[model samples]
Target chain A: MIGGRLGIIVSGSLTKGVEVRLDSAISVEDIAVGRYVTIEGEKRRFFGMITDVTLDAIDQRVMATPPDVSDPFIAEVLAGTTTFGRLHVLPVLTIGGDALSLLEGPQPVKTVPVHFSVVREASEQDVEQVFGQVEEKQFYIGTPLDMETKVRLNPAELVKRSNGIFGKSGTGKTFLARLILIGILQEGAAVNLVFDMHNEYGWKGSSEDRREVKGLKQLFPSKVAVFALDEESARRRKVSTDFVVEIGYDEIEPEDIAMLRETLGLTDAAVQATYRLARRFGERKWLESFLAIEGREELNELASSLGEHEATMAALRRRLDSLRRLRFLVPHARDNAIQRILDYLDRGINVVLEFGRYTDYTAYILVANLLTRRIHAQYRERMERALGEDIAKPRPLVITIEEAHKFLNPDISGQTIFGTIAREMRKYNVTLLVIDQRPSGIDEEVMSQLGTKITCLLDNERDIESVLTGVSGKSELKAVLAKLDTKQQALIFGHAVPTPVVVKTREYGSPQSYKELGFREALELKKKAEEEAKDLWG
Target chain B: MPAKIGEVIEASSGEFTAQCYELHQPPSFGSLVKTREGEVEIYGVVSGAATTSIEPGRRPIARGREEAEEEDIYRSSPQLSKLLRTDFNALIVGHKEGQKLHHYLPPRPAKIHSFVYLCDAEEVEKFSQSFDFLSILVGAGGQADELIAASLRHAAAAHQDPRDFLIKAGKELAVLLGGETNRLNNILRRIKV
Candidate 1:
């Protein structure tokens, strides 16, 4: 640390955290929320994050002016606004060594930093000590807003549990989500499947001004497979396609349609009619045969022959016919589309299912729920089998879903497959990187399951309340949350990070940022995977 | 150069009292005055001044208006200046030992009857370079802000660069006053130009 005194410790009875005032060189207002400051302790150097900065008048004269002044301006000028600042910093990590190095990782504050110690801005070296050495396991998401030091998260922790990225619209939520996926890919810690509703993740996506950003497929071509519901849309955007996933009528289960009940605006009678049709024609072939009946002529023929209510069948057909326009559904041309996804995951290749221009909530929800449900069930079975066998468990999988509230809202959470994965995916090594504008819409149970959350600015009261979780020091954290810049800044805290830090997300799409984020390391792994593919073929 | 005003009659670490030797009336309140103590010189601002007989606990007898004036009785007595003594109380600002000046009270106060000099232009000009003395003056007992402002005007005029001296004093007061910008601004408004 610098030898100069930043401030003196005002309290000697400090037990939990130390209060150190800044020296005259700086003021309290100058220190921003979430800025990292260091205090010199008796035995070790303690690193603290500024949670609050308050201004106070030190003398009564500073607050009041003598009333006898005839000139108002003079009276105004004479009234003292001389204020002292009080910085509420929380000590997070403590280091013990003559020479502080990242290699000597800091431990959680076992002993609070010494009182009366000078507090200074946490230098790049001090910040790196808390985050520790940057290795394959550590993924640098961004640098802290106040310091130039990089803030990295443990990817191993990310894959072991579910996490979330939340922010209001235009707060760079998607950009942050893309960065996290890149981090997950660089580490090869998990096979991520991004359900791109707006077709933004797999192919080139431009920002508001059409600033073209390279998609995940473009970055790692062989490692990521771009699966689009409509091949034409993907081709129009020049997104190289690996597979065309189509959900055939025969493959649509009762649960798949049940997931869409609220979205399709279907009545309870309509859902029961579909079930009745399934029971009569057998569950496997019922959806295919039902789609075969196109008009009222066929509907009337099936109703009379099958001995069912004519109005109920007609309502069911109307709802089913309305959904036929969706490209994912086809009448028995091939087998299950989910098998293809399992094939990609089994091969350790990530899959990004682009919805093409299908950015609608209902379609995105239906497709994501159908595929994730089948795949997550398969994973649950595989995990159970792995427990009994000697073979290693399958590689961890993280599914990135956008508009997460549509599936996880309390209204649908009880039946939505996405909700199931959110609450119980950890045991199956299948976690979610759910992204949304309204985190408050998600069920409280699923919110609690989120192991780590990287949230940008959220103004909605409920959204802020939901994102804050039940962490201690919530009021202080809320203050920090309220001050987050609307662009490129995030507060990361929870299981994946040792402490909460506000980071200015590194520039995405910049070649230099890509290199700094370890894109080369991932490319090397891609080459190795190609080699292994060749050896297997030979 | 201003004339020598009086001699120090009593002294302490923070303040001293002086008896007028030649002047008809004591230096006006908040006047910049000085006295010598050994090799070093001590500085102070007059907090108060009074006229009384050399004899203790005495009050002058006032009769009706004399001559054509309504309040000229005291002036009519020509020997009053000789019979009575005038003294001023000065709050110690600092003392200069050698070439370096300290902005605090001196270790030793002025001696009895040490000749007190009305500060010359050079003396005031050199001391005005540091506004530290203003803190002591403002912190003194009565009407401190006004006294400090008055002292600044006198000192600023003594300095070669009066405008710059006043500006520097204003800056120092801005910090010392904390957020009391009105007081500092008023002082600056009064002292500027």
Candidate 2:
């Protein structure tokens, strides 16, 4: 059994963790890093992870002139007596044996286990006691290493603040994000507004193996709406989208253009010129009027009258002209896209805005920023009014964005609506689920503001460091994070979990997995059970 | 029952010397032997044995050159048997009082002229059940590795699984001589089944 006694605590401290001398029968090679272990102290049971394994000898001379261990008798005798395996264990949480602690559950360990305490491999029940079983608010994300016990992530606490899902390219960030979104939807924690960059979260998404998997809309048609920016592209893919969305020129604000300065390659003067143009023309008419001044003589005259450089105005015009090529941008939109999204969110239905063919940074940044700013303003107004009038506050809304560094990077994070939501939007019932491949590019403040972070294998040193910044036992977690398997494995920690845990992510792309994820088959199974019950009763 | 092998001629708390009753005969070296002082039974391992002239100043000359065989000389000189006595030295490893066996020195030494007996297989098995006496044997001075190896080999023969017994004893020696890898290797090489 996995609960067999592993070893005893030989030496350690509260901060540096403890060292365990393994039993002779347990070979050092059998002990793996990141495996869960529990120490049975006199007063408490401490749970920890194996961070390092080392071969130790009782005598230094034995190493220099090694005994002839080719003989089984000699090897067996020397194994535990003269040589043994040592494990470096970081005790993270303590499940106190006292009655008060039993009621309180696992708490962060403030003291180390006593010397020579018995340490053993953590059993399934012990893990369940710590992470808990799948409950209403707790979502089963995955299983820990060499264990079947589910590691449940608390979606209720997760939605209370912004979160980030990070990994290198092709590390299944989208798949993980989709699972978390499904968790939020399933538990009714909050309504999600996903800015689907590559149409990955709406109707269908292709896995790494190229198999088409059902997206959120196909699974929960009534509770999900897929809005497409390019309807022709959506039609080509045969995705039955809920609505086609467009952005009018008048809807663009000076701040929106200012946030897009990097993506549009606008200089400082050009970025500032947006504010000047908004002042010259009305805030609602600035973009349309700026585009209307086509001739060079009229542009120069307008620039002179506005006390702006002609060259700067020309550069700003040239950069702004690129937005004209985007098919979704028009002088006037058929229906207000922001109102449609807010209405769907207010009705407790999630909305996924599919970029369709416009998956570039320019288009993604422009559309996501413009739509979110207005929606956030609406939420802020409603929240302020709710506080003043004491009416029921708006339902919490989580806005999901990909390539978050583009908006939350240090240079533009102060002005982007996504950055504002990440920093202090929890009071307004709005949080951001930022997905990015390069977490290092994101601002430090935003990264630290994240409530919980679930990341896959990232070998970059800076990325790993940034993800583990401000975390206690950072070095131990770094070792665990660096050794993660590249596929379907993740390390989750922060506000939602009591301790950092490495998990083999749950299955996501099969008929069986779909049923487990609560697809239509689950409803059919429920109905069948109900019918059987009715027959038995009647 | 144990075989009566000798009589304690020299006695001390840590060790005792016994002279065999028969000529040129002594229990095998490193064999388990026990002697008594009143009610306490003191256990010892036969560290060494020798057959020499009983007198301290005299030496014996070889008369076997002209004899047809070595036995003829001893037969011709009947006094030679009395002249040369086989004496063995046993290091006190443990003692037994009442029903409990202790792996430590007794409060008193073996009495002079006390009978010494070679322990039987059952007694050897009972004594070898705990390896605590091993520390005493390891620190018993000269040729300790060889003495430990011989005693363990003799004790193994008393168990059902000789190899398991030797391995268990070998582990004890390994811990006792943790810093002396060469000595441990020598003992292991000798004791391994």
Candidate 3:
């Protein structure tokens, strides 16, 4: 049977949600917060989630001097009449119960259900109707709590704006990110440019139990390109690399250093001095020229000539000297790494740039910021040209970055390219898929700008608050988000899903899962084709 | 036909007093009994019963001092049966109008001298189908809890499943006495099978 009738709407309001009085026959133990339910009103059916449960009695004296309920007879009699359970439901969408709703589908509820409306646990059909069925652009992410019905997320709507995936460490953020990436790929929504800091996405990544799972390249070889910053590390891991990305010292600019001020512990004067050096040596030669200065006397001569404070100049030199230790940075590059990435993205091939062993904060911030700044500028130019000439716009791009707080923290969000993309990059056909553990550390404005947010269990009060910032029914959703399972569970809301839902993230990393995701080797496909041909001939 | 238990000796809209056919043989406390007035049948539960001297203020002397058994005194003085009479009081819980049974006070009292009969198992089963009368019984003033416990026990005897019936009746009492937990608990203790 579909969900049996649980209760009736006893008393409620539109702003504070509705209260349901449970029937005497239903036990309160069977009810859980965050479970979905439907209310059959006079005119339409409303869908909502259970947010709270309470035990109540008709008279306060019954609680003061309690009845002798030790005997089963007294207990049974008093179970519902003298004492009962009450539920608090937040109605979100009105399911099809009227002619208008029947044609247009579910709509956001603007009114409360009439008094005494019946409420039942949401059935599979009701859930499927509200979340929609899997079709061309809809990808199945996971099932709602305790249900077998799949919840579909439309990747097409998802890539139109920036989004975030957050959780505490080891809360399966990586696994969910992988699933979303696969969703984007399957839907062909946009081309992904992932800054793979730990080399997790390009090749095989380990699960929590240290089991290796196939990466994106293994799943779609022809559609994905893996670029490694450390050639030796990529070879060590036995991963086939498509490109080696190295940043030339001449490629570094003053603004890139300014964004890294906090990570490098550089003083304000030191940051300002980089601009002076850039102006003196020209935009492309500042870092190479500054690093070539040999001794304190020569540095002092330049600082005096430029009228820069001696201490600030020395500190800037010392900080700039640390950049030499990063093996991927050289005086000159053999090829343009940004242009190569652009070429791959233009051809609709997703690129995962592996940092390999340089997972240090300084390196990740510098390289990611430097590359994104130039790339965003190029995209801006191209988008304008497309608009002016009435030509086809560039393919939509989604940049995936981890440890996003480092780049999007309040101080640097005003200057970093990631912030620009997050704020208003949709006009230029670019967006960000930010993955972070401390969402509280990200700028509030940027967090609000995210199109959709999928978050795992976050026990910290601040992180939970940050994730639910601009969402309607914030307090109610906070309870659901806080109660999510530590692994393989998340609460997704916003643009893609019709309403907020707590999902047991779809399974990944097994042979059966791989098969379901359409993973096949070239030889196997060819063999199958040959057998089909043989069957046709015979 | 059911045995005639009594006749109404005194009547009121809410309650009626009936004289049993035999001395010292009034109906049991809380058992249901009924009487007819022309076309209407008025139902009531036996609230209290007593046997006393036929005339008020007439105290009889002891006559069984030398008798070996209590029956010998009554046998020796045959007129004793005429001197003593038993009567019972029933609160008008409901009445039968046409074919329907209501759980409310009838429009008029059972007529004086109306013949009363103790309801059988089938009638008791049919009458107890709805618990709407429990509210009237609960509000019947002084020792109402005891009267309710006894009535439900007697009513449960007519059902195939007595414990299930008692539980259902107990739940009804729980709702009616929702504000009085102690009274409900006391009655539930008596009615539990």
Candidate 4:
């Protein structure tokens, strides 16, 4: 048999059953926790350190590795072989290294260089297995920061500040954000509003797809109202006029006017002048009363004197006119939806205003900002009432903003309402879960404020660097984030987790079947339906 | 009785029938035959009545030895002769491999056939008639000569009757020419020709 200095000698013949000790020849410095070595011609790898090494008292020449071995064969083998020879015979392997050299002498030995190998192969079982922790109170940003290791977070620490989820398309930003929301809602927290920009999150479940349906309803019930501003819905509702009226001059604050001026590239003086005009018109409700102002000449004359920025004033007036004409801004009816959402939130019910098909980025930004600001205001009022004396008992409100880069970018100037909420929401227990494709694309300030960051497979280098800059424990987390594979596989860092972990996202309520129908199936179904219709008609 | 010069006769069998249209005398003359909806030319050194009767509407056939030797000449000519008239300079120049012919000739059309009508004599002189004759050249003088040689060769071959060979050859030639003709007809129809 091939024999060498025993790098490690165990009490038992079988590798796994007994305690092992390294040969004195192998220097303590050279032996690593995960290093491998050859022992008695059998290849063996060791996890952790060699705990004990000593000579056998009964047999003067033999060294006893550790623990008492009663087996006669093992005892005889141990008596005959030197500790170095026994330990060295088996090969030591490293994760990315060549097998360790057989121990030649009793002197301390060095570990072999690692040869790269496919040591960890993910199997179908890995994909099918659901691995996560159910925690009390705060969201369990499941698993360790390393995608390979399982680690859980301390839930109590997570809810203190709002979270942010940001990544590029197909990076599992939406799925992870939904998981966090589900975690929080499942813990019996008051219902919070989800300003779903993509309309991907809040889906109603059907009887056949009961799991997904129940999961969605548990998160967002009928109490959660949906307002679709799509062309078809707008036309059908016939409330476009009221929508405009509801977006009254009051909706545009002085700061908002300043922002509008900046966005429109107008002067400060012009902005102040327009603000004054708007304030006066708003106080008198001239926008609402203008329709009753019988004389068109009088209305035109009144609109002209607004300011030197007559163009902006005219646009706003036209917007008002269009709203009235189309009956789109039906404030009373739309307000009912808004109020219902707020009422659900007040009753501790979660509300999701899913924006499924709104393509106009400008409109989405405007509406989401308005809703966030309104929700922040309500939350602040509730916090003040509940913890007037004890600021510590702050009612935590997790506000998950999907596609956050559109509204939360810090570069955009003027009082961005979303930015204001982001900055001040922390004091009122308003946490922001900012979800996007690339974390780098989100406002740097907003990213820095996110205490808990659950990062998934980030293909872009810049996005990975952005997440690294935001999180504190980069060593393990960076390695984990580098290797993320699927939608729910994420390296969760920040206050929510005790240590960074790689966790498979837990299923909340109903499983979402965003799996689109294939083209051929859809076509076949359409043809079949047409045939059936023809048959029925005949 | 021995066959007279230029006299057409039927070559018939239980399964086949052919007509010979005589072209020359000396028992070495070639003749064209129409049988079973196909036409072929054949040549032979001997002629006599066959055992079977000729089918109605089928014409008589003839074949002679000189026609057979001429066929060997047609088969040996290069492909270029089939694309252009024998008089064309390209036939002479292209016959030499690696010799450029572009300067003297227009680009060759995509599809070439033997029976295509040629009004240009320059094309006929430069290209060998065998190579230059397209499937479209059925009624052309060059095709008539080639047919005469082909029929004579068929007559000289023992296993297949000359008349039968001519009929089959005609049908095959028709099929080969049919594709190009249909394509040309389509082009003409598109142009409202």
Q: Per-candidate DockQ versus the true complex? A: 0.14, 0.81, 0.78, 0.00
Residues A137-218, model 4: lDDT tens digits = 3344443222333343433355567566655566666666665665565454435567666544554422312333332333
State the C-alpha lDDT per candidate: 0.77, 0.90, 0.91, 0.42
Model 3 chain A scores worst on lDDT over the 10 consecutive residues at A515-524
Best by lDDT: 3
TM-score of model 4, chain A?
0.57
Residue-level lDDT tens digits of model 3 in A1-538? 2498989999988777899999877889898888899999999999999988899998899889988878888888788788999999999999999987799989999999999999999999999899987663357889999898898888889999999999999999988998899889877999999999998888788888899998988877778999999999999999999999988998999999998898889999899999999999999999999999999999999999989999989999998888888999999998999999999999999999999899999999999999989888899999999999999899999999999999999988988999999999599999999999999999999999999999999999999999999888888888888888899999999888889999998888998777666465434666888999999998
Model 1 chain A lDDT-worst window of ten: A73-82
Model 3's DockQ?
A: 0.78
Fraction of native A-B contacts kept, per candidate: 0.07, 0.90, 0.86, 0.00
Model 2 TM-score, 2 decimals: 0.94
- Order by DockQ, highest first: 2, 3, 1, 4
Candidate 1 residue runs with Cα over 4 Å from true position: A1-31, A39-46, A50-119, A133-138, A294-310, A333-336, A514-538, B1-6, B10-15, B20-45, B48-87, B92-111, B114-143, B150-193
lDDT of 2 at B144: 91
Of candidates 2 and 1, the better by lDDT: 2
Residue-by-residue lDDT tens digits, candidate 3, B1-193:
6899899999999999999998888888888899998888999999999988999899778998999999999999999999999999998889899999999999889899999999998988889998998999999998899999999999999999998898888878878987888898899998887
Model 4 stretches astray by more than 4 angstroms: A1-156, A205-215, A218-274, A283-304, A310-328, A331-338, A389-395, A412-414, A473-483, A507-538, B1-193
User: What TM-score would chain A of each candidate receive against the reference chain A?
Assistant: 0.86, 0.94, 0.96, 0.57
Model 2 residue runs over 4 Å out of place are A135-138, A521-538, B22-25, B76-78
Q: lDDT by residue for model 2 over A1-538, one digit each (tens)?
A: 4888999999998888899999877898888888899999999999999988889998998898888889988999888788889999999999858665699999999899899999999999989989987763356889999899999987789999999999999988998998898888777899999999999999989887888998997777678999999999999999998889989998988888888788888998998889999998988899999998879999999899989999999999999999998999998999999999999999999999999999889999999999999899999999999999999899999999999999999888988888899999598999999999999999998999999999998889999999988888888888888888878888899999888898888888898777667576447766888999999998
